[model samples]
Structures are given as C-alpha cells and as structure tokens.
Target: MEWTQILTLAAKEFRDRMRNRWVLAVALVFTVFSLVIAYFGGAQQGAVGFRSIEFTIASLVSLVIYLIPLIALLLGFDAIVGERERGSLDLLLSLPITRLELLLGKYLGLAAALTLSTLAGFGLVALLLWQRIDTAGLYHYAGFMLSSVLLGLAFLSLAVLVSVVARDRTRASGLAIALWFFFVLVFDLLLLGVLVGTGGRFGGEAFAWLLLLSPADVFRLLNVFSLDDVRTLYGLASIVPTSLGSPGVMGGVMLAWIALPLVVARWRFK
Candidate 1:
C-alpha cells in the first residue's frame, strides 16, 4: 500500500544485484549462448551460420527451457531465507513497510533484474537478426523473448515461495533445485511414461491440459503453437488441441503460473 516504502526496498534490492554484477553476469551468459545458438545451431546438420528466425528460435527455445528456469531459481531461492541467514530478515521486518509490501518489493526487484537481463541478451540477437528477418519473423521472435521473460518470472515466483517455506538457505536451495529438476526434467518424462505405459489411452485428449501443470511446458506450447512449421516439429502440436493453443489462452495460463505462486508465498509468509 505504501508505494514509497515498496519502491525504496525494491530499489535497494535492485542496486544490490547491480553492485554485485549479478545482472551483468546473467546478461552476458544469455548473450553468449544465444549468439552461439543462432549462428551454429545447424552445425550438426552439416551447415553453420545464422539460419531463419524460426530455426533460430526453435534452438533458442530448447536453450531457454533449460537455462532460464535454473537461473531464475538460483537467483531467488535464497531471497528471504538468505536474509534470515544473514540476520537481516528481522531488521527488514522492523521497517515501516508491511510484510506484503516487503514481499512484493523483493519479487518486483528481482523480476526487474531478470527481465532486463533477458531483454538485453536476446534483444542483442534480435538486432543482429534484424537484416536477416522480415516483419513476420520479427513478430515471432519478439513473442519468443516475451515468453522467455514470463517463464523466468514464473519460476522465480516459485523460488520465492520456496524461500518463504524453507527454514534456512540450505533447505531453500535444495528445494529450489528439486523444483527445477521436477518441472524442467522429470515432469514431462513422468507424463510421457504414463502416456506411453498406458499406450496413450490414459492421457489422450486431456494430455494438453495436463501440460499446464508445468510452466516450462506452457512456455514451450506458447512458442511452438504460434509457428506452423515449428509446430509440426514439436510433438505437442499433435497432442495439444487447437483450442488450447491460442496465444491468448496460453498467455493467460502463463500469467496464472506467475501469480499463483506469489499468492501462495504471501499466504505462507503471513
């Protein structure tokens, strides 16, 4: 409710990240990985150079699927718990800001840092691809960048939730990594195991809806379903119905993924 207090806290948090060069480091990592993928993504196909935006995005999607979530998780897993471990949580709580304002400030500051890094990193690639891609390609590539930010924010929200729930930084980090592995690595495999073990009869039509459980999958669908060529390349195109593939629908699901975790975190923190 107190904008000044929240903004002050947020500014402090953001400045800490800047002072420590966390934002710069993450941005550089994204820049290097993206540039490499864009240019050498086709090396295995006996070709090496910047390909079409579609192909570049496809390769980048796989990279973002693995990288962004982990980065976001590590960045935020210790937000509150780290404060507690350093004996600063009580000092922060003694401030005039309400707990809600404090939580929102922390989350917003971290989100801003992540968003800036993502945009700067990928925006550089967008600039490099400007001459190569047409208007349509620009549109698709822009969408990919936006969705990548959302995916990171959603996972960061989960990390904040973990920070609130765990008693210490060590447990918070362990839970954070477990969450990353479960959502990024194990969730889909488990879904597939069930679908395959049951001969697809168990998860036929409802499979697409089930993908909503993992923000990573939702991010994948958001990108893959938009492009016709890339859509076919992904098996989800067949499993995810056209109804669930709408940009608006998938975007809403992603927004929910971002919000629900924060809501739960706030409740638990209270």
Candidate 2:
C-alpha cells in the first residue's frame, strides 16, 4: 500500500468528520457528563465533591461502557454502506486507491476522530482535577482514557465490518444496534444465567476465558484490575482470576477485538 495515498484518504475522512461537527458534539457530551459525575455523582450519599481518582474512575467506567460502544457503532455503521447508498462507493472505487488502502484509511481516520473526542472530553476533566489528584491518581485516570479509546476503536471496527456486509445503510444500522446490545447488555447476563442455571457447575475454567469474547468486558477488566479500590468497587476481583487480569493480557485481547473485525471487513469489502 502507498503511504501517501493512504494518509491522504485518512486525512480526507478525518476532515469530513470534523466538518460534520461529530467531534465537537461528542466532546461536549463527554465533558458535560464527566463533570456531572465527578462533582455530584455521590450526591445521594451526601458526598458531593471531587472524590478520589479511583472512585471517579469507577463511576466513569459504567458510563463509558454503555456510552462509548453505542457512540462508536453509530459513528462507523455507515462508513461503507452510506457511501454505497449515496452512489459514491463505485465512484471512489474507480479512483486510483485499492480496497485495502481505502478500508485501512477509513478505519484509521475514524479511530483518530474517536480518540481525539475521548481525550478532549476526558482530558478537560483531568485538567480540572489535576491539582486535587496525585501522580498515581493521574496515571490511573490516564489509563482509563487510553483504555476507553481502545474500547471505542474495537466497536468501531465491528461497525466497519457490518457496513461492509450489509446491503444498505438501514440494515447496517440495525446490525450495529444489535451488536451494541449483544456486547454491552446481553453477553454478561447470558453468561451469568448459564452459570446460575447450571449451579456454577458448567463453564468452569472456560467461562473466565469467555469474557474475552466481549470487548466491553475486556475493557472493564483492564480498568477494574488496575487499582485496588476500583477493583473492590467493581467486585470482580475473585471472578476475573489474577492470571487473566494482567494489563498486558487484557490489552492484547482488546487489540484482537479491534483486529479480527477489521480483517473480516477487509475481506468482505474486497
């Protein structure tokens, strides 16, 4: 692949998203919700102020898991199908770029936009709380932001694959929402139901491995296992064995989530 052509296409995609105000809207949403959760999240218990970084991160994880995946799916579900519907895909194909370069360029561009929005939104909160938080706390918060970006990219990869396989934008969107539901809402519940139904007898050792199947779960474990207080708050200390909880392991799994879908998308698009 020619780096010049790939970078040019990526820049075009990024500029298109910027022109559409997608980045600004997402950044504002992140900033507003993050500030609210940081300051008033513990209001019910009469503890309304800048809490510890671990506590803040724990609160944000729930929000990120639900919000990021949905946002990512929506952002990328139309990457290919929308172009096709607009009668632009064929026109673009008639150009000098190859399919692999086009697909990679699109994914990289979307990933950049998603990462920027995440950082801008969360980075503002980090700045506001910097004086109050210590070095370790800052590090933890940074990790959360990084992992959040990874989680978004993973889902966006899936969206690109859906766009490639679906015949139309409508079906692509339906598939995106279905994916969000399956990974974010249904996957863990199904696992718990199976374990409960079988009295914890079935899916023994393999069950722990199964969590890797859902990118959201991998993201959860990556952040939750990082800090002591946050881990206790999440209550997954026992369930997610020490062996599988390594940052290296979880990061690799998240990378796989990002890669497998993109590989399939490249194939399908071809």
Candidate number achieving the greatest lDDT relative to the actual structure: 2
In model 1, where is the ten-residue run with the lowest total lDDT? Answer: 232-241
Look at candidate 2 and give me any clashing residue pairs.
none
1-270 in candidate 1: lDDT tens per residue?
998888887888899998999988988999899999988999999999997888888899999999999999999999899999999989989978788898999998999999999999999888877999999999999999999999999999999999999999899999999999999999999998998999988987788888999999999999998898788778666667898889899999999999999999999998
Clashes of each: 0, 0
Give TM per candidate.
0.98, 0.98
Model 2 residue runs over 4 Å out of place are: none
Query: Candidate 1: global Cα-lDDT?
Result: 0.92
